[model samples]
Target: MKRTRALLIAPVAVTLLAVTACSGGATDGAASGGDKAALVIAQGGLGDQSYNDLANAGFESALDATGISGNTIESDDVVGQGEQLLRRAGQSGVNLVVDLEYSHNEIIGSVAQDFPDTDWVIVNAEAEGDNVASVLFQEQEGSYLAGALAALQTSNTDDPRINEDKVIGVIGGTAGVGIDKFLVGFIQGAKDVDPDVEVLTAYSNDFGDPAKGQQLAQSMFEKGADIVYSVAGGTGAGVIQAAEEANHYAIGVDDDQDGQAPGTVLTSVLKRTDLAVETLVQDFADGAFPGGETVSFGLKEDAVGLTDFEYTKDAIPQSTLDTLDELRQGIIDGDITVWNVVTDGYPDFYSGS
Candidate 1:
C-alpha cells in the first residue's frame, strides 16, 4: 500500500529511472502557469507500480491532454524531506502541488500558509488550510466486498481452493489507520456475511518485505485459511507469490492485480489513484480546485471498488457474483454503509487505529 494511503511507505527494493530534465520536472515541456504542477511521490518511490506509478500515470495523462508541465519528485525519506520539497515546489512558481506522500498531510497546512498563492493536495489524510485539499478513498467499501467474496468462497466446498475451514486471513503492511481501513472493512464484511467466520490478522511492518509477507501468509494457510487478503505494498507481492506456491487464493490491493498471478489472485481493491490525479488536474484546469476542502472518492464517486474478476471470474460461482453485486449496490445506495476509519474513527475490532 505504498499508496500514500498506506501512509506507511517503506522503501521498496527496486530501482527507478525517472526521466528528468534541467527544471527537475518530468520531460515533455517547460514550466508554465496553472498548467504547471508538482507531484511529490510518497515513499517506495516510482517503480512501485502500485501507488507511485498509478498516480504518475494520471499526472501524465493530464499532461498529455492539458499540456500541463509537471514533474514527480521521489524521496527516499519522504517524511523527513517532504516539507523541503513542498517548499521548493511552491517557490518554483508551481500553481498546484499535489503531494502523494501521506506524511506531508500535517506539514501541508503550515507550508500552504507560507505560500498562500500555491494550492496543495494531500492524499489519504486530511489537513486544514485555505490552499490545501485532501483526497480520501473508500477503501473500506471495496475491502468489504472483498471480504464478502472471500467468505463465500471459503465456505464453498465445491471450490477446489477452499476447504471446510470457516477461516480467512489478512496481512497488513503496518498497523496504522490507513492499513486498518482495509482490514476493518474486510472483517466487518466477513462477520456480516457469516457470523461464525474467523479472520486471522497480522502486520508486516515493512511494506517492501515480501519474505515476511509470504511467511505470514503461509502461517495463515497452514491454520485453515483458504483466502488471504494482503494490504501490504510491495510486501503484498510476496503474499501473492506464496498463494501461487501454496495453490491458495490471495486478494490484491490498489490496482487490478488479478492478472498478476492469473487465477491465484481473487481480486484487487481499486483505490483509483489514477482517477484522483486526473480529476485533480481537470479541476485545476477548470478553475475549480477545491482548495481548503476535502474530496472523497467512495463507491458513490466510483473512486474505489473491485475488479471484474477478469482472470478469475470463471473460477467464481455466479451466485457469489450476484451477491457481490448486491452488496456493491447496497453500498452505493446507502443501504449498506461501510465504515470510514479516517472520518468515522476506528471500530471495536481495530480498537484504536
Candidate 2:
C-alpha cells in the first residue's frame, strides 16, 4: 500500500457502549434510529489510486445506493491509533465500520470484542470476532497472469521494443511471507508458460524507498532482464521509472499503472479493492452483513486481473495477446491453479526442493 503524506487528527477516547451498539445486529432501520456508518481508510489513505482508492470508490457507491451517509476517516499514525479510531467510530454512533489497514487486524479483533453491536470490516488480513468481517484478495492469481504476460513479451524479438534476452524480473518490497506469495505465483506462471524462461528476482527490503527500487531495477536491466514486475508499494514508482529510462517493459501492481508511463508500462496486476468494499457496505445496509466470516475474492470472482494493455497493446503481437487470453480463461476455468506462497509451500518445480 502507498502511504500518503497527509495531515491527520489526533486520536480520541471512545465510550464502550458506543462500540457495543455498533457491533450488534442491525436495528429496526431509519424508524429505529439506526446510526449511519463510516469507513476508516488505511494508512495509505486516498490518492494512492490503488487499495485506498478502490475502497473509497466502493464506499461511495454503497452509500449512494443505500442512502446511508458515511465519512472516510484517514490516519497517518494508524498502528498506535487502531483501537482509538475504531472506538471513536463506535462512539460517533456509526453502525458499521470498514477498516482498510492491514496491520490493524489484531487490534480490530480486540476492539470488536468490546463493541459487539457494531459491525466491522477489515481487508487483506483476518480477525477473529463475530462482528468482524475480513476481506482477502487473491493477489497471486493475477500475478500469475502478469508473469505469463512478461514471459511472452520478453522473448519476442520481432518487436523492436523487446530485447533479445528472454529474461524477466520481479522486485518485491521484502522477503516476507506476504510478498513471497506474489513472487512464488509469478515465478510459477512464468515457468508454466515457458519452462526455460529465466526469472531474476530481488527484494528492495523497504517498501517506502523509491530510490532503492530504481537501483534494483537498473541492476536487473543490466543483467539482461527485458521486463520487470513490481510488487513493492510506492517503491514501484521507481521501477516504472527505470523501465522508461532503460526502454524496457515494467509491470505494475494493485492498480492500473499502464498510464503511469505510456508505452513503458506493459500492464498492472489489478486487485479490485473497490468491489470488496462495495459488497461489504451494501450487505451492511441491507442488514445482511456476514460477520465473523472472511470473504475471499479471486480471479474467479473478477476481483483480480491484468489491466488492459492500453498503451502497449499495439506493441504486443496478436499471437501474444491470444496466448494471454487463453491462459486467463484457463485460470478462470480451473485448468490453471496458481500458487499461494502464504498457504502452500513453494512448489517442487520452482524450488526444486
Candidate 3:
C-alpha cells in the first residue's frame, strides 16, 4: 500500500522552549570541566548486527573523533528500564543521551521533562521535550528503490536468470506501524516501476525467530517468489538461508547483508544509523543540538540507501543497475517522492491507479 505525503509543520512553541531551556553551560567537560557524553542502547541490544550495531558504530565514531568519554548501556529489557536508565544517566551528570529504542519515545519524553538540562536523542520515533532530538530516517525511499529493482528483475523473459512468474516477496517482522511503513513503500515502488508486478508479503510475527523466517521464505519461494526482501531483523538471517537453499535472492536490511550468503543475498536497505548517531553527538558537543525538534533524514540527505551488490553485481544485468541508479537520482532530485506509509496516508498516485 502506498501512503500519501503530508506537509509537515514545525512546532514553533517547541523550538522556542528548546532555545530557552538549552541555554545552560556544557555539562560535558569538553567545554566546562566535566566528563564526556553518554549513550544507551535500546531493547534489541548491540550484537543484533543490524539496528543496534549500526547505532553503536555511530557512537564509537563520535567518541573517537571528539575524545568524548562515553559508554553504551544495553539491557534486555529496554522498554521496562527506559525511565530507570534515563534517570540514572541524569543523576550521573551525563551531558547527552542517545537512545535507539523505538518503544521508549513516550518514556523518554516524560523522563526528559524531569531532566531539562540533559540532551536526549531518540531514533525511529518522536518525543517532545525541551532537550530531546528525534531522529527519523526516510526508509520508504530506499525500500521503494529496492521494490523497483525487484520488480524489474522478476520480469525479463529473455534473461535466463529471471523468474517465470513476475513475483517478488517481502518478509516483515511484524505488522506494526514501523514494519508496515517499509512494506507500503516497497509495494508502491514496485507498482510505480511495473504495474503488473506481483509483491508477495508476509509477517513472521517475531523478530528473533530465524526458523520462522526460513519457513516463511521457503513458502514464498514455492509460490513463485524468486526474490524476497526481509525486514525481519535476526529472523532475517533465516531468510538469507532460505534464499540460498532455494537459489533465490534475499534482500537484507539495516546493515550490509550482501555478504551473508555471497551471490544469494541480493542487497540491503541501509538505514545509516551510524551516520545519524555520529552527527547527533557531534552537534551536541558543538552546543548546536537541535533539541525539541525532529531531524528527518532521507534520500535527499543520503541517510538511507541500497547497499552495493557486492556478491551479485556481475550476475545482475547492467540495464537493471542503470535503471536503479536513475531512480535513486530521481528521488534525490525531488522528481520522485517515495510514499511514507507511516507518516502519510495512501497516495492518490498509487491508490487504485
Candidate 4:
C-alpha cells in the first residue's frame, strides 16, 4: 500500500498562523479522530502562484471534502521556527500536521516523537517516526518533458517567440538536490533532444524574490536564450514577468502559469502538490494512514507533468506535441529514465554548491 501517516508531508517551513477556521462543529463525514489539521506553508508563502499556492489549493480542497477544521501557518522565518510551529499545532489538538517546508525534515522526526498523538508529514525529505509520513514527487520526470518542449521550441524561428539561437535557460530558487531535481531533468531532457542545445543555469537563492529572479532571467535572455524555465517559487513570478517584457518564452513550475502571460509562457511543469495533500487528508480521515513508509507521486500517478499548453497550444506544432506524448509514455513505461538528484545525487552535466 502507499505510505500514509496521520500527517501530510509538504515542502517549505512556515512561521505564523495566517489563516484559521473555526472548529465549532464537524460537518458530516468529518475525520472522526483527526478532526483538526494544520498545513504549514513553505518559506515562499502564498501568492507564489507556484509551489506554495498549489499546495494550499489542495489543502483547502481536502478540508472541505473531509469537513476537517484546519488552519494554515506562514512565517518569514519558517526554517528557524519550523519546530516551534509543529509543536504548537500538535499541542493545540491538531491531529494532523502537514509541513510544506523542506527545511523541517530533521526537526520533524523529534517533533513527531514528542507528539505521538499527532501525525506529521514532511515533503521532499523523509523523517523517521511511525507517525510521520514522507511524500516525494518525481519532479525530474515532468521537468524532462518541459525541457524537451523548450528544446523543440527554442530554434523554431517560425514562431516569433522562438529565437534563432538554440539556447534555453532554467532558473532555480536555491542550489540543492531538492531544487536541482528540476534543473538537471530539464538539462538532460534538452540535451537528449538536441545535444547541441545550450542550457544556461542560474540561481536566485531566494524563493520569494521576484527582482532577483527577473534579474537572473533577464541576464539569461540577453545571452541568447529565448525560453527560460523557472523553478524559483514566488521568485518565478519575476522570471515570467521578465519573459513577457522581453518577449521571450518562460516555462512555469509547480503551477499552471500559462494564463499568467497568455503567449509569453511556453508551458508550465506542474508538480501536483494539491493531489498529494488531498490524498493525505482522506487517508487520515479514513483510518488508513500508512505511517512508516514513503508515498511517492510521479507521472504515472499524474503527480507531475506539463500544462496542456492552454494558451500556447496553437503555437506548438502537432509533431512536437506528439513527441512530448511519446516521451512522457517512455518514462512511464520505464523505457526512459530521468535522473533523480534526490536519490542519484548530482549528474555530470551540472553541479551544485
Flag the better candidate by TM-score, 2 or 4: 4
TM-score of each: 0.89, 0.85, 0.86, 0.93
Please write out the lDDT profile of model 3 over residues 14-71, one tens digit for every residue. 1111000112222344444454566677544556668778887787767665556666
lDDT of 4 by residue, 1-353 (tens): 11123433234443234544534235677666548888888978878998888897888888777777777777777887777778878888888999999889999999999999888899877889999999999999999999999998886889988889999999988888889999999999999998999999998989999999999989999999999999989998899999999999999999899999999999999999999998998898888877877999999999999999889999999999999999999999999999998989888988542
Candidate 2 ranges beyond 4 A from true positions: 1-34, 205-208, 348-353
Ranking by TM-score: 4, 1, 3, 2
**Model 2 deviation from native, Cα RMSD in Å:** 5.7
> Which tens-of-lDDT digit does each residue in 1-353 have in candidate 2?
11223234463523111111112233334213444777777644456655667677777766665656667776655656778888877877778888887778888998888888889998878889999999988888899888888888887887766788889999987776667778888888898889888999998876556788899999999999989998877778899999999999899888788898999999999988888988998788767899999999998899998988889898888988898899888988989888886678766755410
Q: Which candidate number would show the highest TM-score if scored against the true structure?
A: 4
Error of 2 at 144 (Å): 0.6
Please tell me which model should have the higher TM-score, number 1 or number 4: 4
How well does model 1 score by local distance difference test? 0.81
TM-score of 3: 0.86
- lDDT of residue 69 for candidate 3: 64
lDDT, candidate 3, residue 6?
26
Q: Which residue runs does candidate 4 get wrong by more than 4 Å? A: 1-19, 22-28
Better of 1 and 2 by lDDT: 1
